[model samples]
Target: MLTSFYKMHGLGNDFVILDERMGALPLTPDRIAALAHRRRGIGCDQLVTLHAPTVQGADVLVRFFNPDGSEAGACGNASRCVADLVWRCSGNATPVLQTRAGVLPTSRTPDGLITVDMGAPRTHWQDVPLAMAMDTLHLPLPGDPAAASMGNPHATFFVSDFGMVAQGHALEHDPIFPERANIGFARMDGPHHMRLKVHERGAGMTEACGSGACAAVVNAVRRGLAARTCAVELDGGTLRIVWSEQTDHVLMTGSATTAFEGTVDLAAYPS
Candidate 1:
């Protein structure tokens, strides 16, 4: 059957969204991987699915999947895009999204930006779920990266240069990180600004990573390298991240753009 899909992007971290709110589709890991293939399928950093909310107070249940077909706990950029879609469809200015990580609350900024309250960063070693307990502030790894979970495991390496990014893949699979992790190479530009590049676990390097940026800022703040409110510049664009002292929630603000829309035959892809 022909299924409708929306192509959306947030700071160049793009996704192919399949809306299954009306009904669930037959989707498997293999099918998801096939659709996410850049060369032979609709290209996207990740594939997202929108389902009817199963919990109270949530506008929708959103799921993120990588090109390699693995499910992710959270996706910051994709959340903004999904919030916009729900707000448009339901006329709810503030849309709540439920994911594996937790429920996320979203609102629109005065200047047309989407702001998602991504809850809080988990700094506990058990939360990051390392193979063994250790100090999350400084991992027992090269460059002394800090670890945090923004609904997913993340390790931020504060570097003066990005040359260390070449080791992202290696560190992502390091023994310490049991489930693997998103590796971020961050260069502090100022007290309130920094530049970042992320090697997402399943997706590899993307133009931008919403959760990765949040984790980076949270870790930076813990290290006193950046202010609570920081601006993260990625290869695709920039994002405003604020780690609220009062709420302990990380608010991520950025633009969500619709690239195009199309229909695809799910049956044609591998199951």
Candidate 2:
């Protein structure tokens, strides 16, 4: 059977989105990895799927899979892409998405930017789910990185230079992370501006990472290095991240675009 899919991106972090709301589509880890292979299949940083909402108040259920076929608890960039698709199909500017992390509400600004309410950051050692108990504010590691969870584990290392992309691979699999982590290296351009590069847990280095951007800002704020609201510049584009003090939620605003749409026969891929 052929499955229709949308090719979309948010600041160069691309995805293959399959809407499974109307019908069922078989998706196994091997097939997902096969479909995400750049040389052999439809290339994407992640694969996303939209399904009928299973949670109260959620407009749709969104799932994110890394290129390696690992399921992600949340993906900020893909959430915006999914929100845009949901809006275009339902005419609802604001849509609620349910994921493994929880329910997330999204909105479109008058200027056409998509904003996702990414909920609060989790800073506790157990919450970030570190292997052992330690102060999340100052992890006992080289460069003294900080850790936080935006539904997924993340470790942010602040530096004077933004050339730490090479360190992401080793840091992402550090023994302390247990489940591994998205590694973010941030250089502060100003009190409210930052330059970031992230190595995703399963997808390796990407041009952009929304949740990584959010984690960068939150870590900066926790370290008193930046203001609550910050602008994060990634390789592909920029994202505005605001950690609301009152609501304790992180609001991420960025662009979501459609590259194209097509169909694929899942049976042809590896099972």
Candidate 3:
């Protein structure tokens, strides 16, 4: 049977949402890409689906796929959108959504913004899943491989300028990472702030990436270039990331807005 969905965005990090409490639709990468297409589809940066918990005793499961069809561990803006939608559907004040990174807690604020506690950031080499064993904070991108977790995996590189690189270079062809990774560049401004040019896996070059911004800060700080908490400016906008020495997890707070919402004709999507 065909499925129903809605569209939302958090600081230009958009998502196509499906509240599958009863599991009506099977979400796949190709389908996600189809729905995210502006020319032939609804168009979004990410696709979010919420369903009953996969593991017993856990809260609802929130799954996400980038426009490229790859599933991500967590998404800050998308998580907020998911929390708002779940709360609206279930009438629960505080909702939990399980992800690969583990259980994430989200609450609907009076201002209508969804606030999520993104468990923690895994900064070590093993936790960040770097193939080589070494210090994750300072380890240079093997090639295009700059990876860190804002409860998700991201890889970035330092470049003199981003205007020279093509948009969305693939990981498959890059040698630094055996498994393809999200590629981007970091341009430094000072001891506390910098800018990012991201070629997001699955989504290509988005206006901004929330988790990516956090990863960029950690990457710079670990490398002894930037401060823990600073303003990260991206192509789309800016996000403030706080990485406390006391708490390993990165805290990302941003704005989310409900753009228009409508259901797509499933038949119009690709198989």
TM-scores, all candidates, are: 0.99, 0.98, 0.84
Instruction: Please report, as a residue range, the 10-residue window in candidate 1 with the lowest summed lDDT.
Output: 84-93
lDDT tens per residue, model 1, 1-271 = 9999999999999999999988989899999999999988998999999998889999899999988899999999999999988777688889999999999999999998999999989999999978998999999897999999999999999999999987888888899988999999999999899999999998888899999999999999999999999999999999999999999999999999999999999999998
**RMSD (Å) per prediction:** 0.8, 0.8, 3.0
* Tens-digit per-residue lDDT, 1-271, candidate 2: 7889999999999999998899878999999999999999999999999899998999999999999999999999999999999999889999999998789999999899999999999999999989999999999998999999999999999998867778888888899999999999999988899999999999999999999999999999999999999999999999999999999999999999999999999999988
TM-score of model 3 (CA atoms): 0.84
Candidate 3 residue 175 Cα shift, in angstroms, is 2.7
lDDT of 2: 0.94
| Comparing 2 and 3 on TM-score, the stronger one | 2
| Model 3 regions more than 4 Å off | 55-59, 87-93, 107-114, 134-146, 167-173
Off by over 4 Å in 1: none
- Pairs in clash, predicted candidate 2: none
